[model samples]
Target: MRPDPHVDTVDHPHADDLHGDDPHGDDPRTGSAGHVRVDTAALGRVAAAVTAAAVQAGDAASAVPGLIPPPRWASAYSAERAAEAAGHRMRELSADLSGTSASISTTVLEYEDADARTSTRFRAAR
Candidate 1:
């Protein structure tokens, strides 16, 4: 399947740092010196695209059994098994995509919440 054009698949410049052992090195809550900006709108778009793809994959999986004819001979039994396996894999892919979409949406919400809390804290401090 073709990748969604709306999703930014490019790796971030600080991608490595994000997974580094220094948990507080870039954490905003720790008064870190670095900043990481999140584009929540873009993330929402990505989540939507992933959800659509998951639906398509689920539909394809449902149709796989009908598309593959029943084995008429012993030689075709292997082919039938393979088709069943493919269908199973497609179902798994659909589930994974749905999970990924949910995770992305959750990330967007977390970022927005963090921004709002930070803004409130700054206002209270002033």
Candidate 2:
């Protein structure tokens, strides 16, 4: 069966320190440093774009005619999804990079490939 492009937003906890690190901590210009957790349930709206992108990527892979099957590099898909989640988190983060602009602390961006499996995590910096 073909994979579904529509990714379900699992019941993940809303976290400010998803990245477990903060960039704009104790900014004298920003007044104070803190974290803002979000309602994962509300993540539905934010997850839409990421889901679509994944579907597109998958479709693109299916179209490519290569010597071998397109690699099932699951991390690539997961990263795309997490990136979307990060975008959502960035918006919800309460930092004024500009008027109504959420300046989320840059989190740890890393990718690891495991034999037969792969994953990527985008932890939002505190």
Candidate 3:
């Protein structure tokens, strides 16, 4: 039988504590069994990049309609409609990107606030 790759076999310090096997029935690092760590700096950078892409998408949306020339024949009407639809889709994408950027920013702010509150509590306890 192949050894389970997902399971760690090597013994290490605090391994049992991390796995919720502590004798005291609580994690030593925190009061909980699991922990979450977020890199706000990286999230901020990603939010900035997303915001930039949204701006570019908005610019493209604005330019798309004009790039397609006026319909000169009956058959061209469908092409014009298609171009308009493409532009509309681009606008939707830009809106979605903007929303995503805002969400990321909000998440970073929430994480930072939680960290600050945790630090304050720890300091007060100390």
Identify the candidate with maximal lDDT.
1
Instruction: Enumerate clash totals for all models, in the order shown.
Output: 0, 5, 0
What's the best-to-worst order under lDDT?
Answer: 1, 3, 2
Candidate 1 to truth, TM:
0.70
State which candidate, 2 or 3, has the greater lDDT. 3
User: Per-residue alpha-carbon lDDT of model 1 for 99-126, expressed as tens digits?
Assistant: 9999999988877776777778879999
- What C-alpha lDDT values do all the predictions have? 0.74, 0.36, 0.73
- Which is the leading candidate under TM-score? 1
Cα lDDT tens digits, model 3, 34-112, are 3433557778889999999999999999986364565589768887778889999999999999999999999888777
Worst 10 residues of 1 by lDDT: 7-16
* Pairs that collide, model 2: 18-123, 18-124, 19-123, 19-124, 21-126
How does residue 38 of candidate 1 score in lDDT?
56
Q: Whole-model lDDT, candidate 1?
A: 0.74
By TM-score: ranked, best first: 1, 3, 2
